[model samples]
Target: MYRQILVHPEDRNLQRILWRTSGDEPVKEFQLNTVTYGLSCAPYLAIQTLHQLASDEEDQFPKGAAVIRRDTYVDDILTGADTLEEARDIREQLTHLCAAAQWIEQR
Candidate 1:
């Protein structure tokens, strides 16, 4: 289950998501593409959409694994890092980007 949960409540965009899976199964990979519904002006929807595109952010993962990539009406985000440290770094960068209104948070 990869659901985008809004961390801090605010008029502006601020959020984080969790993706979990089970069973020892072969993960299916795909060339991902993202887009916004272009209806609601809420970060929740955008965050959810990102997960919908790619949401396998589990603990046990391969290195340099760039997971989710969501493209809004005119914006986008790329989450999922190779290592824990890389993921944290990505989160920081994403936080700032969202604050700057670049594309909003998709954690």
Candidate 2:
């Protein structure tokens, strides 16, 4: 089973840049200026980010790869796989993704 990971967006600090021309509009892109997603108080922000990433990656593999995410008071991730290898692979990827975030097993 995949680890119930708790990722924090603060691990990567956010930065805002103001670059606007006299006749140009302003656009912004969130810049992750910190580590990974495990070094802040609000861990759910990072969890949300990971959830989107997982969703995007769900179709990459044909196996039974279901990335489950629960964000109540915190972030909870449960990855479903038909085989142990697939499960373990998902867990490994999650660990790597949150290499800087705080994560532990559900049970």
Candidate 3:
């Protein structure tokens, strides 16, 4: 999720950190220009952003919007279907829906 959502330029200052594995060298300042894994609000914010996107494009992706609103838990998406084809279709729908929402799925 590091590069999925970008950190606003003005807010990048808050995500900065000092790096120095050992005390032998001077510490260096580093800034996170994108959303990273450990931040408290990262997961929630990411999910909420998707939810908002789904809501905004409900007409274009009704099923995807429903899935985003009800089937997701944190970072996991729990969905199923009676047949394998249906399940795969749902998965594909979710994938394309995410792309249509302008979210780049990051592994």
Superposed by TM-score, candidate 1 places the C-alpha of residue 3 at a distance from the truth, in angstroms, of 20
Off by over 4 Å in 3: 21-24, 101-107
Candidate 2 lDDT by residue in tens digits, 10-99: 642444344555546765546544333344633655446455545644565322124434322245554466899877877766555444
**What TM-score against the true fold does each predicted structure earn?**
0.26, 0.33, 0.74
- For model 3, state the Cα shift of residue 3 in Å: 4.5
lDDT of 2: 0.46
lDDT by residue (65-101, candidate 3, tens digit) is 7888999976688877899987777777777777874
Score residue 18 of candidate 3 by CA lDDT. Answer: 99
Off by more than 4 A, model 1: 1-78, 102-107
Model 1 Cα lDDT, one tens digit per residue, 4-31: 3232444223222234365565554432
* Better candidate by TM-score, 2 or 3: 3
Clashing pairs in 1: 17-107, 64-82
Query: Number of backbone collisions per candidate, in order?
Result: 2, 2, 0
